[model samples]
Target: MIFIRKSNDRGRSQTKWLSSFHTFSFAGYYDPKFIEFGHLRVINEDTVQPGFGFEKHPHSNMEIISYVVEGSLEHRDSIGNGSVIKPGELQIMTAGTGIEHSEFNHSQMDLLHFLQIWIVPEKTNLTPSYQQITINKVLNQFVLIGSQNKQDGTVIIHQDVNLYVAFLTRNISIDYSLKANRKGWLQLVKGKIKLNNQTLLVGDGAAIQNEKINLQCIEDSELLFFDLSSN
Candidate 1:
């Protein structure tokens, strides 16, 4: 089975400096029917104006990953971790019991565009931690970014989810074999592509439950694929 979620169909939240689109129910945007998919809870695409950002916030029992597309986002947490994430970088945070963190634009005049992902943990109350990696070395193909066992040198998370990303050239095609009892979500972050027979543009999302996924790049593209265990 496959379901398509158009970019405009997503829930939207906009403030003076922040414009966010929620792939699942988040913040003030609520839709009971779209609460979550499998263990993939949230995928928020956010744009922040220069000199603006989110203040300290509390989270628990959730594994969060931050991917910067443009500009830079600065992160600070109660765990005494502070860093600036730039384009082609990722930040992972495990808010096990509880943790406080803040994300803000690291620049004074550049718009910050990024994706914030949330996945439910395999077990609760484990431990709070942080990890980061630079993906400039892995471009033009699907590469593991987050996983449970440090698989493929990905940032370890507290869930049975494996996150992969690709930077594909025009007219390229790639195949992914999806294991039985598992499902996947493909998100087109930039440019255009064809997932199986479905054409997806920027901000479009596709959920696939088939045994295999075939991606054909219509143009230069950036994509994120999540392989999640069926619960």
Candidate 2:
């Protein structure tokens, strides 16, 4: 089964300094049927104005991932983790017991664009931690971004999930085999692609299950794919 979610169909919110689009029910957006998929809970695309960002906020029992798209984000957390996440960089934060964090645009003039993702951890009340890594080492193909095992040269997550990123160009095709009883989700960051005959454009997403993923690159594209245990 494959379910499509269009760009404009997402929950939208705009503030003086922030504009956000939510793929799943978040904050003030609630849809009984769209609360979550598998263990993947939230996918929020955010754009922050210069000199502006999120203030210290608390979260617990969730695995958070942040990927910068265009500009840089300055981060500081209760765990003493602080850094600037630039384009091609990713940040991982595990709010096991509880944690407070803040994020701001690292630039004084450039708008900061990024994606924030929240995944439900397999276990609760674990210790909190943080990590940030550059993704330049995983370009132009499907590269593991996060996994339960730590040997994949990627960030570790407390869940049965395999997250991947790929840069696809026209005339290229990538094939992915789905494990039994697992499901998938594809988030297209830019350009166009055709997944098993289903066409998707920039900012589009699809929920997939019980089938192979045949990715036909219709144009130069950047995307994220999640292979997750069935919900």
Return the lDDT, model 1, position 208. 86
Q: What is the lDDT of candidate 2?
A: 0.91
lDDT of 1 by residue, 97-197 (tens): 99999999999999999999999999999789999988744556779888889854579988888899899989988999989889999988999988887
Residue 64, candidate 2: Cα error in Å is 0.6
TM-score of every prediction relative to native: 0.97, 0.97
Total clashes, candidate 1? 0
TM-score of candidate 2 to 2 decimals:
0.97
Q: Which ten residues in a row have the lowest lDDT in candidate 1?
A: 133-142
lDDT of 1: 0.91
